[model samples]
Target: MAYTAKDASTTLFRYLNITEQSIKVIENTNKRGFIYNTANGEKCVIFIYPISHKSDNSKNFFDTRDSGAYERGVSWNYALQNKLKYFCFAVHDQVEKYNDYVFSLECQEKIIEKVSGTLNGSRIGAGTQVVIPNDYIPNKQFERIFTKNGFFIAVIHRDNIIDYIDKYDNRPYLIDDSLIELDELETNDEDSSQSVALDDEYLSKLSRNRILFGAPGTGKSYKLNEDREKCFADGNYERVTFHPNYSYAQFVGTYKPKPKFRTDGTEYVSYEFVPGPFLRTWINAQNSIKSRTNKNYLLIVEEINRANVAAVFGDVFQLLDRKTDGTSEYEIATSEDMREYLIKECGFEADEIATIKIPSNMYIWATMNSADQGVLPMDSAFKRRWNFEYIGINQGSSKIKDSEITLKPYGTVKWNMLRIKINDGLTEAGVNEDKLIGPFFLSDKELKSLSIDEIFKSKLIMYLFEDVLKHRKGKIFKSDFNTFSKIIDAYNEGEEIFDFDVVSFLPDESNEESALGSVAEEPGKYSTENE
Candidate 1:
């Protein structure tokens, strides 16, 4: 059962051993609230607001409505004037209980948006009300209590008034005295709760699950690496590449044989559970939370689609549906072996070891290229959980704009320019976008290779021949040089290799630099070494 606003205040006051100083009412404004103080001299004002009928179990929130509205009226003005702390408790409706539990967050002093209504030429709610921002709520579940008939009681441990709220307030607050002292050396003990409000300016922004996909050499991996450094300042990250044979046991965890040493310095073989990247990342995230570091932990998968993604993720895939806070909306049970390992080696509490979840601070990002073959397909259900961002073929082309590629007889042209021309021709020939050449296809270092002809044939021409135009060779290569060997021979002998005019490959026909007039190396900004 759920308790009403008046009943909640009465019961909460008793639980906290609060001495009520009566409801302070301004007869003219109809402004009213109960003022109370704890034994340790923490003064606070409580405003009772009913839970909105439209609210659901998905989230616990409330609206100030007519209760807090005042002409030129505003939030916390009374508490501010009295120099008292402020708290608002939102009680959930009885009909929406789950497992005999009612869910409602215990947050304070948050105003996200305004409810526009007028009363005697004054804005309702004085333009601000107490409400938690969906994104700022912590991953921990809300506080709940049971009620029967009209009696209101708290099932929580008996403690001081401030300690009582800290137990169930899912909304983050500044709790440590050292941190509070660092911000303000002379924090008033009577109004200390005033400092617990969320910082409206500082937002913990992090995307939990994202997949960057595009053609080869599009800088997907490079971009992921760049973001990792910027996001994880403490360098908490684990990187792994997915291949055809990658499995859930290897991705998450599994039992493996281990060698143990006895007192006599003799080694003996034993079997035990071994954690993989997934478990290692989870443990780091849990430790970060326990320490209140508030830092992000990242898990980077180099080629997500290369392996059977659904099979590799297995049941853990369900954790991808993140809430506004970047945490999994649901938790999944872990294998018995995994539970024991997490609790023993990772310092996870026994109560929480049975289940696993992607915490609000743990992020999983991956890169995939749809153009590659021998890779498994991803189902719609699996794909929908990730935010698919396409890394365009020319996404960061400007960075490597100075690199040059040599033409058969037309001198040299910018590597990016030649790539653009080839991409245009390939697209015109009905080739897929994923099969087109990217700016980073040939690194500036590769362009300066002594065996430029061989490098070009193996890197670019072979792709165009073997895969891009496997069915139509003459579409890109010249009709006379139809076979892969013919194109290579013509390219090596300084003959036109493309079906199109050789001059078309050069940006300026006037550039008469010899094939050996290589472009000087430029600082590399993208990864093309393994493209």
Candidate 2:
């Protein structure tokens, strides 16, 4: 609640605390603002302009006829750690938009020059300084941005010092830090600068070694995919899944046989070092850095715990501790094979790839379900290097409510309804939440299938019969559906699997068809991993 806090009115008066008497927009003024003391040893003034999206317009952004008075509200988007932070204004659902008119030539140009790479935003036509997708804005509450918790506007910041023009009006600006209540904590400008530097969003953006872990089907993978598409803008990324046999050599790099023909036409086998996902991504990040390209690179590891993670990461484990700039805190020396490969093939300096270090723009994210059958436990030392995000069972229920699950014999039930019933039963029976089904336990196509297909049974019913409901089967299914084969057969053969009259909870046909009409399922695109 920076706006509500003492000495933070440039934003509050400009957008939130609006009244004709307090923050009136001058008829002829393009923008106006006052100065306030920040902890950075100087004054900070925010210049903002009022704008809102017009729903009726399709092609053009702002309506041009100028006679009408516009009523603007704001979406008070804040990080979980820092409450009541920044609010963005944009016509689109994802990226916030601001025209160049609101910013100074320096703020407009320098914002793109100095901050575009570090900030997850793009500028257009040099017209807007920043265009950030709200979700990618770390520490932000994702759902509230779209709901218009309030209307939005644009803001800019610059330093202010006492430079008077004349005896009465020598300074460029008209406001003072004392014009607003000076928060005791913000009395010094340097303290405010340090506070801004340690903001949650800033820290999270720099160091992104995060793991989305939860029970099967809880949308851990779904959430990660979201981060893939939105947070990192779906470019300069690599995806790898880890399993029991997945090893460090495969993850980082190893030499493999390459068949080649000599000039004499004799075929020969050459052992060539092939860089795996990790090294390949690092190489790309290094190239991007060398070229000074403002691109973010990602390494998505699905089912991280499915493999013996320690063995898979091997010596690279130490490289997980990221510095504030997101580079590996420490570098691990590369194997000889890797060093030779780096110099000859990847254009790396002998000194550079001799040791492997993760780059700042490069990120490693993973999905884990400890309840999975073959999952290997992570040591505390390894676990401490990553931030864990637990996907709640209902984390994304709203997206799939229209999905219908039809038991050939029991009839069609809303996917969410049946999922809730199953989860509730498991909970009441004392089954751990981690052993329960998640919102994305079944894909849309799987949910719509009348019979339990191989994909469906293996992904879901087997999970329920073998793990989640192994000891708690009586809560949802018949006591004698004891074995995986038995329950799956019952499910596929039109026999009653659930003890309850689930058909009684079937969603209305009209609602189902109207809502999910012809919505084609793009397998693995939206919901791939069952983590």
Instruction: Name the regions of candidate 2 deviating beyond 4 angstroms.
Output: 1-207, 233-235, 450-459, 480-495, 503-531
Question: Which 10-residue span in candidate 1 carries the lowest summed lDDT?
Answer: 146-155
Q: lDDT tens digits, residues 317-351, model 2?
A: 98988877778999999899989866654445687
Q: Which portions of model 1 show Cα errors greater than 4 Å?
A: 1-206, 407-410, 448-451, 505-531
Q: Count the backbone clashes (under 3 Å) in each candidate.
A: 2, 19
Top candidate by TM-score = 1
Measured on C-alpha atoms, candidate 2 has an lDDT of 0.52
| Whole-model lDDT per candidate | 0.58, 0.52
lDDT (tens digit, per residue) of candidate 1 on 1-531? 344555544545555555445445432232335555534556565554444443443433344434444411232445544555555544432433321222232222211112223222233233323333322222222222211110111212223234544332222222343432112223222222322332323324334677887778877788788767555532356788999999999999888776656657799987877667787677767766865645467889999999999899999989988887778988999888888776554435678867878888788989998889888999988887877766676767767767766656446667766676677678788998787776677766788777666688898888889878987777777878768888888777888777676555445524422321232223232223112
User: What is the lDDT for 415 in model 1?
Assistant: 72
